[model samples]
Target: MKKIIICLAFSMLTWHSFAQDIPVKITKSELFKDEYKNSNIVLVEDDGSGGVVIVRSYAGGIFSSGYGYYFEHYDSNLKLLKEYEYQSKVKKEDKKIYRSILGVIMNGKEINMIEYIYDKKLQSVTFNALTSNINDFDFTSKELFNMNSKDAESGNSGKDRDAGAQMIINEDKTAFAITVDIKDKNSETHKIYLFDKALNQKIDHTFKRDIKDRKFIYENIDVSKDGNTLYLLGKVKTDEAKKKKDGGRYQYELTRITSTDEKTQVFDTDEHYAASLKTIIFQDRLTCIGFYSDRNDSRFKGISYFELDPNSLAIKKSKFNPFTEQFMIDKYGKDKDKELKNLRFKQLIITPQNEIILNAEEYYEVYTHVMTQNGGGYDRWTYHYDDIVSAKINSDGAIVWARNINKRQDTSVYGNPFFSYTSTAKGADAYFFINTGEKVRKIRKDRIEFKEASPKRSNLTVIRINENGDFDYREVLDDEENEVPFMVAYGELTGDSVFFLGQKGKKKQLLKLTL
Candidate 1:
């Protein structure tokens, strides 16, 4: 084991902003210091009053059978306080691709690390749950289970869905929810599994619904505060039906499951088609909000928001077309008839002033192919991440102001999304850390131009938007002048301080920037 500390000094580490200079420091991991190149990595993080808790897994790709995991605790300055390496027993080579996911959990006095090793088969999925206690640095439990997926039995047709696919373990480590959609006995159905703190099966129920013509897409899962109930939310899709002018819509469904019985509510959006439906759980009730399109299209036209009772699955009140025209211009150089397309909303934020600040970004995908000796290759995708929007809405479901953070980012490779952007708010003001090309032109207050980034010329800009829908940009980290890492959008925003992972030229470190 090594001390694993590399010191890199910035121009000003003390609160690095106009208000106060945030002290920035970098903590190199033992993996980075040892220069382990054969390791596949997955990082899970959660912030605490003491510091940030991080659980990391290092292993080989799909061909490898073992995993090396560790847990580290960091202080306010991103300094490592403690570290414990975990040993895994999943070293058996099955010659199949296995997906691994890492999760961080603060259970009482100990930090629990959860890893899911799952593989999809023709008709069923083998899901292995592994848990380790970081405080004691020992394995706690490893459970393997099988569930149904797709329609492999009738001829190995339909989609190759993961039977025991979606899993969510609550933060308190009290309850875990698993939902899967499978073709059971020639019927398209869904199953919900509830487990206890010991990962023991508590309740298992199969959903009774006639969704033969529709496909189930899961969205979110929430557990009751009393630990007595679980809720699942999702959408059901259909093919286009032109006769009735129905291009089809994703009907919303919220299911509430108790230990004995389950209740489900399946409803539809009258005229607008929803993009992505999300559920926000509150102390008293649950709310779902999403953007909508005019018809069956995916382009966002307005906002759809409503609150419902958690137990009955009944709507208390609902509001439609809740968004005013945002400050936007389409790619054609003129204003469009509605809000720009590809605007995906993120987690809603509540401010000290009791205002709801909704943040969204323009994102879309492109498909391409390569001509080969075999005529054509499989389709490849490129993701373009563009401008960001931050809107302040009142308690009465009204938009007070909408601010747009202009940017354009592109990458040739797939799966990386090319770039990233995020926001951190204080009081009524919001700050954003955006990644852009070094040669990208200055964006006018109301307009922006798209430019591809030069290789190794990416920089991070800190833009602050006031309450009045006004914004100012500052390029704090430049790769040309300093070793300012190109990745700042990955930071976690806490109070007035923000922390993220950065690589200066090639040196990786945990960066702390205070606004």
Candidate 2:
């Protein structure tokens, strides 16, 4: 009986160890190391074809005139496969000219690279398509599109010719090049070109819009998952009367375009405000989440959802509004005098079930008072702090749960707090919040609730939340011995493994977590 009891205990211990999840092991390799230090590595994609293409940028170099370097390829295990370096033939006696590579994409078996070359005699752009399989990579392919700096500059004004040229590659390996050109009268116009998989120009379109005392700044244009729709987000100016009437508001629009249409459908928001739109395709249905806010506001007062008809490029029934009154009143009491107003939503994410998670923040001023019981005078001071809030809403616009992330007397860093929520490969979601506060008088200012002293320099909190917003497990990454500041910029569920892009020792590192 004693031996049997001892054997049972050993079996249980072994089972527990086997069930524990461990972090993924990472091995570092120098893909490119020569004359260039502190290079920016843009990891494009792991083309299940057993290779990954990385574009390294030399912001400024002694021999280079501009900011980009070249394209380097690595095998599935990160072994250096091949490299294509660019060199200009232009001769100059002054300082060395530089050429920078901007965009790259894999077209079938070949790879396409774009570079911006700057020299005393000439400033131009170069496009090249190279393949690892030389026999299959045809240079004589008429489907290839190549544009030089002169062609790109022809659309720009004297201010900064290189400022507006940006490119995007679609799902079918087609490319769209967008450039902003300044007219003779100093007005700006946008030009968009569509190129085929082989880089040949398929269509060219240009349009101009008038603005009152406002210069056009190009932001971002993304091709939708269906490969037919494009979404453009950018800012515009408002006339004086419109600005004053709308509380100093400017106009921002979310424009969507399709191949069959010549005019784009523009969704304009109120002025002095900005908006962000996130679209996801789930189970063959398209869903969009948009957040809008004013310039100085931290809380997003507007939230909207839209279901689109992929074939017609039209929104089916879209609903938009501020947070529901019941949700606001429940978390922040219904006291009319103590109402939390002017809050703005910052982030919006959708779960697998089509539920929406919104995170918002509000800023307010408070007065701090100190009293003395003895024969002493009372003292008072005023300070400002931002209240961070999070809420989970269902597909029907019902709030499932809500909470405020801020604590009393804790000084929150404006624009410095880290916010992220990601889904793991195990179908579980993990939410992370890291707040970096200023250390004063040897006292730790910001700390995660219920957790022990976090890293004095930086604090990190990781919580695993269920699909219904229920907490399952939580982990605090800060330890006494490991005081370094760690951060996660990107995360993905690759196959059965979870990969995370983070930083340690000022060098970017990748973390893999496995179950």
Candidate 3:
């Protein structure tokens, strides 16, 4: 559940404090048969019996009807033990379909698979749990809830697409919340449902407000430690004319929900604008933090933090810390016009000492035209994943250190499936695993760069940032020695281990890294 890593650009910092290289191991599975060659891993978990459970979806494979799943059980040695193929109940007639996996958790000796499904005939959406025994693979299904969907949002643009629904699990995974937006006359209505890990419903409520002048676009959600309260963050859209006078057309709002009442708080600052916001409970307090800009320009100016009253959703303590000079130099070198923009939050880590580590990446899109030989052309799109920014904030909401990692990667592919990095924390230190081909180099007195690398023939490099903000890098998997490229972005962190799935055509393997 803790996903994070750090990159350093300070030239004077020291190297890794650890004496030895981090332990890593790669285990290759038997070549998947041609019939199931195009499968991708959807879930991986430790079986609690010196083995692992991996679930793969072959929905778009040559032999699949776009609804088949492969459930595999493997021993400690990565040897396949047993496997089963399961398909969903689907109709191809004249109906829109939507299904998205919520999560999977172990229940006794069985695994409970939770999914959100849209029932076309009934004109509604339902949460369903499919339980499968680990020993004999016996299967059963039960409906968790069925709700109206006449004007609800749907995510069914194509096969294997995610539904327009979102779910958030608490730190302990003991409880979860699902939120949906329904179309109304001029704005939108929100549906919030809370449930325990055992598929028991806790609260079902709906909220409607701000419909006359603005609409709320929900972004993130979090639950309290006891699962009795829910927090929702969203962007409140105002009139477009406000952009010319105030330089911003949107403001941030935080909504707190309980079984009996709902409250909302709008974050309005006269001097600055919130570019992004995420909520987390730290030190027994509800805290909201993100990036902000002096003007409503797309560029960010610094980090923002706010400690809120748990019951009122009101800001009790707040700070807006501007980026240090060294961080700006690390990102733009000497370019005065270049600025940081399009940062999407990736990981939020809270240390033992109550320090917060914030991580994000620069992502954007571009469109062009590719002409064919016949003199006709088609539009081409490229998704860019460019840079990494990390910062450490102390208990007083003061930023202690902030750094940026420079890299450039782009792909026209839909998933961008293999480009981003995955992270795990080692105490106060952070480690990032990425695929890169170029050598690490110092670009300036305060700038360090990790050049973009080919995804197919790249080295798996691990970047380490110690507690003091000093950092170093090492290649764990050399491209020449390893043939399969890992989908590093999809790696899962479990205890002291990280699991990743590697695939190349008809060949697939499982890679485990022990920290």
| Candidate that would win on TM-score | 3
lDDT per residue, candidate 2, 1-515, as tens digits? Answer: 00111111111111112122322233223312344333444434555675555554445456654344445555544445666543333345635454434466556556665544444345544444333332233323122333444535442354643344566765334554544343323444555655554566555556456652144444456555534556554555545424455422444444555555544434444343334455544434555555544543343554655665544546564655555554344345441223345454454555556666766555454555565788676645432334455666566655566544432223333222122223332343435333333321121232233222222344433434455554433333333323233332234333443334333333333333333
Scored by CA lDDT, what does every candidate get? 0.58, 0.44, 0.72
What clash pairs does model 3 have? none
| Candidate 3: segments with Cα more than 4 A from true spot | 1-34, 38-40, 49-51, 61-63, 75-79, 89-100, 156-163, 212-214, 238-247, 334-338, 371-374
Q: Evaluate residue 363 in candidate 1 and report its C-alpha lDDT on the 0 to 100 scale.
A: 76
What is the C-alpha lDDT profile of model 3 across 1-515, one tens digit per residue?
11112222222112232344554454455434434555566666778887788777655544444565677788766667887777664557735766767666655567777788776777888888888887777878898777788766565532112226677777656678887665565655668888876777887988676553135556678877787788887777766425645545677778889889989988754467776688888536788888888766568888989888888776788898987665777687753544578998878877778788888888889999999999999999998887888888887888888877787778888665578888777678777788887576667666667776776777777877678876777777778866477787777766666677776665566676656
Worst 10 residues of 3 by lDDT: 1-10
Which regions of candidate 2 fall more than 4 Å away from where they truly are? 1-37, 47-98, 108-110, 118-163, 169-188, 196-202, 212-219, 234-260, 266-288, 293-299, 306-315, 321-461, 472-487, 490-509
Q: What is the lDDT of residue 244 in candidate 3?
A: 42
Candidate 3 lands at a TM-score of 0.86
lDDT of 1 by residue, 1-515 (tens): 33344554322433345343322332322213322222222333444465666654566456654566656676654566777766544535644434444344454445544444434544455455555554455556555456543432221245534344566666345666666555554345666677665566777777655655236666677766555678777676644322335424557788888889988887666666776766765556677777777755567666667678777888876666534444543233344575457787654676777667778878788888867897867777778777776777655556677655666776665434226566777788777776666554655444554354543556666677678877666666666744434344445554566655544333445555665
Clashes of 2: 23
| Each prediction's RMSD to truth | 5.1, 11.0, 6.7
What does the lDDT come to for candidate 2?
0.44
